[model samples]
Target: MTRHEQQSRLSNVARVDSFSRDTREFVEASMRGDGCLVRVTHASVGSTDIMARRGDYLLHPFPGFVSGYDFIGIVEFIDRPAQSLGLSVGDRVAGVLPGMGAHATRLRVPSSLLVPVPDGLASEDAATLPLDGVTARHALDLLKPSPRALFINGVSGAVGLLAAQLAALDGVRVSGTASPASAALAMQYGAATFDYGDTQWPRQLLDQVGKVDGVIDHTGSRTLNSVVKRNGRIVRTAFGGPVGHQKAATAAGFAKTLVQRFAQPSEVVCSTPMYVAMKRRSYRRDLTKVLELADSGRLKPLDPVVYDVSHYREALDAAGQPASGKKVVLTFGE
Candidate 1:
């Protein structure tokens, strides 16, 4: 497209707004990037977007808090010295905002939070990379797994799949519980699959793949002491609440239990989305490495259930609804 064509498109840019049912307007953000504008082509509606729409995420709700985390887009503008990062206008890029705001056509991304999306990777695929991949890598970095087997509960979900594959890369044999439909795909990512459809999956896992070195629980914090060995690590990055996890952990009597949560620079967290967001600057190395693997067809890429910005409501609803593997995304800047 010519400069005139691009200019005309920018003047009519559309973006999804706050999750508040009352004030959820389709508004526009600044077209200018102050030398840092990202024209988002794909933005993922993650668990945070789903929960925020229900008005239950943040303790104090604001009127116009935009709902989203990860995004992939062409760099439309670059005001600062992004050349150091090999970034320039028209480069495809991916990023995660620590606070909400990626669910828009235009995002004013800082240089520190952005990375060039590898050539040949789809925006939808890269959109899943920043938040979930960073999360999976961060957890493994903390765990430092060695030639041991770990079971990932809820293995078919976005983060679980990434963690499963990454754990395998780090020499941990990965096993995970998934619906029978996704059990094969989970195995493709190197997890020994146990059918979650079985009401007795815990027992099934023990009988088939005895004695896990650790467990990554994404099932609303249900403890796995019944299947995990003593002194084994159980990491929770699930949704809803951790009340069930707390109860299960205490009742099951594990020697040590780890609850991964939002992290700060002064501390480290495991297996949580916020862990990636806060560590965006520090996580650049691993983030680039994973996207490289994706481009080379060596990593398990997320398949997105994409919607246009006009279907924002359906997108949010789909995001909240039960699904396996594929994440819900909103696309703009066509």
Candidate 2:
């Protein structure tokens, strides 16, 4: 369905039959038989890609697959339904996929999964918003009635930073755990920061801000008992453990974290409770809201460190470094 004449190529993350490991290599890929085809300009590098590469993500696929979650691109072709939604060829767009595939040079995705990127927003900034921004929104959404105070774990992280900004916009008091290097950045987003490297950081937060009305915890369950007030809400975004471990181990760890969180007197929830079929309408709406916030300068995205698609390995390595506060992104035709 593509209007472009050139063939499509992608960095395929080929997985073993045993699902024990994966390797990346360039391969030919065709546009989806259905949906619109996008000429990908920039794609995000996230921990999900790292986890998928290691076969540790809970939804890791069998056989082999492409391994990216979000992308920004130009619409090269559109179906009637896409046209009905007001999309046109050459319109800049950004979106996240239900499964991994955005790493490639071209993508065939449903029109409902896509959102228009605002004109003033750079593609690199738009690239980081889809996955993390929606996740942060989901986390905040779980806090019914809207808590007056919020504490986010991993405040320097992609999701945590966006959550901080969104929470601040709602006039919520925000405090979070961050590395010393990222503390000032967190403060810029209206969060009081504590050094997570300190074992007593929980106490530090308690001393400075008292118990919070809610917690968006990406680290694990261990911090919940101390930071969250009794009966406060909890949104669990990540499980505690290494990313390159076995799938069984990852599931086990996730279950254990759930049990621990539920054991608390507080209300425990998950940003993504399960990996069911995606609701394209809801995803498109939330992504649109996040993009608008960024466009209006209400939610400022951190400047990402961009890399060419050819230097993907270096980008991955840089993303894994603990001290690097910036998001890593891959570009095509730059």
Q: Any residue pairs clashing in model 1, and if so which? A: 33-36, 33-37, 35-78, 35-79
lDDT of 2 by residue, 1-334 (tens): 3643545423233223343433544466555556777888998888877777766777764646677888899998887788777899989999887767888888887887788999999999888788889888878978867899898988888888999889888889998888898899888877888898899988888888888888888655565667777768777777657555545555765676567565554545454423213566766777899999999988887678898888887877776662435688888862
Give per-residue lDDT, candidate 2, residue 328. 86
lDDT of 2: 0.76
**Each model's RMSD to truth, in Å?**
5.8, 3.2
Candidate 1 C-alpha lDDT tens digits along 1-334: 7987565345223233444455544664444444477778888887756665555554214444666777888887785678878899998888777766777667777777778888788877777777888877766665444428788777887878998888877778888888888888888788888777777878888888887766666444443657766545566554335422333433232222322222210112253345555665567777888898889887868888888888887887788774777888788844
Following a full C-alpha superposition, what root-mean-square deviation does model 1 have from the true structure? 5.8
Off by over 4 Å in 1: 1-25, 29-35, 58-63, 79-81, 197-199, 220-222, 239-273
Model 2, residue 94: what's the lDDT? 91
TM-score of each: 0.79, 0.88
Off by over 4 Å in 2: 1-22, 61-63, 246-249, 256-277, 322-324
